[model samples]
Target: MKVLVVEDSDRLRRSLGDGLTKSGFSVDLAADGHEALAFIRTYDYDVVVLDLMLPGQSGLEVLRQARDEGRDLHVLVLSARDQVADRIRGLEMGADDYLIKPFDFGELVARLRALVRRRYACKNPRLRVGRVEVDTAARCALRDGEPVHLTPGEYAVLELLVRRSGTVLSQDQILDSLHGGEYAVSSNVVQVLISSLR
Candidate 1:
C-alpha cells in the first residue's frame, strides 16, 4: 500500500516515513499542507496521514479543498489536540480516522489497515476470489489452499482488483493505484498484468 504523511514537525515526519516504510508501505512525506496538496494532485494514495497543525495551509483546509475538488481520498488525521470537538471537526471535514500524538506505532498501523479495509469494504483481511485467497496484512496469497507465489507487481494488481471487486476499473486507474505516483507506468501495463492474472 502507498501512504502520504503530511506533517510539519520534521522529527515526527521522518519517524512516520521511516516507520511506515518498515511496515511494508511505500510512503511519501510532505512538510506542509501546500506540499501535501501538490502530492495529492499528482498521486493516488491508499490513505493519507495528515497532521492538523501545519504551515502554508492548515490540514483542515487541505481536507476541505480535497473534498470540494471531489477527490475521494481516504484520510487519517493526526493531531496533538485530542479533544472530542477537534475529532468531530476533523471527521466533519472528511477525515476517515483520527489519531492523537504519542500513540503506539502498532496501533497506528492497525488503525490504518482498518481504515483502508473499510474504505474498500474488504470484510476479510484474507481476501477470497474464486480459488485464490489473499492475506493482505500478511502480504501472502494462496490458491486452492496451497501457496501461490506472485511477484510484487502481480500482487499489487490483484490487490487493487480485489479491493474494488465488481467495479470495472480502466487501465489508467489501475496503473495510478498501483504506483502511487512514485513511478511512471505504461498504460498497457495494466492489460499485461490482467492477462497474467487470468
Candidate 2:
C-alpha cells in the first residue's frame, strides 16, 4: 500500500516514512499542505498522514478541499493538538483517524493498517472471487485450494480489481489504486497484468 505523509517537521517526517517503509508500505513525504495538495491532485494514495498545522495551507483546508473536489482519499490527521475539540474538528473535516504527536510508532502502524483495512476492506486483508482467493495481508493467492504465484505488480492489479469486484474499474482507476500518489503508468500495463492473472 502507498501512503502520503504531510508533515512540516523534518525529523518526524523522516521517522514516519522510514518506519512505514519498514512495515512494507510505499511512502511519500510532503513538507507542507501545499505540497500535499499538489501530490494528491497528481497521484492516488490509499491513505494520507496529514498534520493540522502547515506552512502554506492548514491541513484542515487541504482535507476540505480534497473532499470538495470529490476525492475519496482516506486522511489520518497527525498533530500536536490533542484536545477533544481538536479531534472533533478534524473528524468533522473528514479525517478518517487522528493521532497526536509523540505517539508510539507501533500504534501509528496499527492505526494506519486499521484505517486502510476499513477503507478498502477487500484490498487490505483478503479478497474472494469465485474459487480464487487472494490474501493481501499475506501477499499470496490461491485458486481452488492450489497456491498460485504472482509477480508484485500482477498481484497489485488483481487485488485492485477484486477489491471493487462488481465495478468495472477503468484502467486509470486500477493504476491509481496500485501506484498511489505516484505517476500513472500506461493503461496497457494494466492489460498485461490482467493477462497474467489468467
Candidate 3:
C-alpha cells in the first residue's frame, strides 16, 4: 500500500519512512501540513500517517480539509496527544485510526494494513482469485500451491488488482496509486508490469 507520512520531526519522519518502506509500503514523507496537503491531494495514497502538531497548518486542519473534499481517505493520527478527548476529536475530524507516539512499529504497520483491507472491504487476509492465492498478511502469492516470486512493483500491481477484483482499473489509476504524481514513466509501464504478472 502507498502511505504519506506527515511528521515535522526530521528524525521521526525519516525513521517512519524507512520503517514503512521496509515493511512493504510505498512511502512519501511530508514535513508539515502544507506539504502533507499537497501530497495527499496529488497522490492516491491508501493511508496518511498524520502528526497533529505541525508548522503553518495543524494536522487537524489537514484532516478537516481532506474530509471536506469528500475523499474517502484513510488517515491515522500519530500524535503525542494521549487524552481521550484528543483521540475523540481526531476520530470526529475524520481520522480512521489513532496511534500515539513512542508506539510499536509492528502495531502501526498492522493498523495500516487493516485500513487498506477495510478500504477494499476485504475481511480475509488471504485473497483467492481462481488458481492464485494472495496472502496479504504475509505479502506473498501462491499459484497451484507453489510460491510465486514477485518483485516489489510486480507484487504491488498484483495486490491492487486482486483487492479491486471485480472493478476495472485503468492504467492511469494503477500508475497514480503506485508511482504517485511526481514519478514520470512511459504510459506502457503499467501494461508491461501487468504482462509480466501474467
Candidate 4:
C-alpha cells in the first residue's frame, strides 16, 4: 500500500516513514499542510497520516479541501489534541479515523490497513481473484492454495490491481500508487509488472 505521512516534526516523520516502509508500504513525507495538500492532489494514496497542528494551514483545512475536491482519499488524523470535541470535529470534517499522538505504531498500522480494506470494500484480509488468493495481512500470495513468491514491486502492483479490480487504472495512476513520486521509472516498468503478473 502507498501512504502519505504529513507531519511537521522531522524526527517523527522520518521514524514513521522508515517504520511504515519496513511494514510494506510505499511512503511519501510532507513537512506541513501545503506540501501535504500538494501530495494529496498529485498522488493516489491508500491512506494519509496527517498531523493536525501544521504550519501554513491546519490539518483540518487540508482535509476539508481534499474532501471538497471529491478525491477518494482516506485520512487518519494523528494529533495531540485528545479532547472529545477535537475527535468529533475531525471525523465530522471527513477524517476516516483519528488517533492521538504517542500512539502505538502497531495500532496505527492496523488502522491504516483497515482503512485500505474499507477503500477496496474488502471486509476480509484475504482476497481471492479466480485461482489467485492474496493474504494481505500475511503479505503473501497463493495460487491454488500454494505459495507464489513475488518480488516486492510485483506484489505491490498486484495488490493495487486487485484492490481496484473492476476499474481500469492508467499507467500514471499505477506508477503514482506504486512509487509515490519517489521513483522515476518509465511506463515500460508498469507494463513489465503487468506482463509479469499475467
Best by lDDT: 4
Candidates sorted on TM-score, descending:
4, 2, 3, 1
- Candidate 2 lDDT at 165 equals 83
lDDT of 3 at 56: 98
Q: Per-residue lDDT for 1-198 in model 3, tens only? A: 789999999999999998997887878899999999898877678899999999999999999999998867999999999999999999999999999988999999999999988886755888888999898878899999999999766777888888889989988777766633333357777888899999
Question: RMSD for each model, in Å, please?
Answer: 4.9, 4.6, 4.7, 4.0
lDDT of 1: 0.85
Least accurate stretch of 10 residues (summed lDDT) in model 1?
178-187
Candidates 1 and 2 compared: the better one by lDDT is: 1
Model 2 CA deviation exceeding 4 Å by range:
122-138, 142-146, 151-154, 157-198
**Which residues of candidate 4, in runs, are more than 4 Å off?**
122-150, 158-176, 179-198
For model 4, residues 1-47, the per-residue Cα lDDT tens digits are 88999999999999999999888788989999999989988878889
Q: Could you give me the TM-score of model 1 versus the true structure?
A: 0.70
| Candidate 4 displacement at residue 151 in angstroms | 3.6
- Tens-place lDDT per residue, model 1, 1-198, is 789999999999999998987887778899999999999998778899999999989999999999999987999999998999999999998999999997999999999888777876745678887888888877778889998788777788888887778888877667766633343445577777788878
lDDT of each: 0.85, 0.85, 0.87, 0.88
Off by over 4 Å in 3: 122-152, 158-198
- For the record, the alpha-carbon RMSD of candidate 3 to the native fold, in angstroms, is 4.7
Q: Global CA lDDT of candidate 2, please?
A: 0.85
lDDT of 2 by residue, 8-65 (tens): 9999899989889788787889998889999999777889999999998999999999
Local lDDT at 160 for model 3:
84
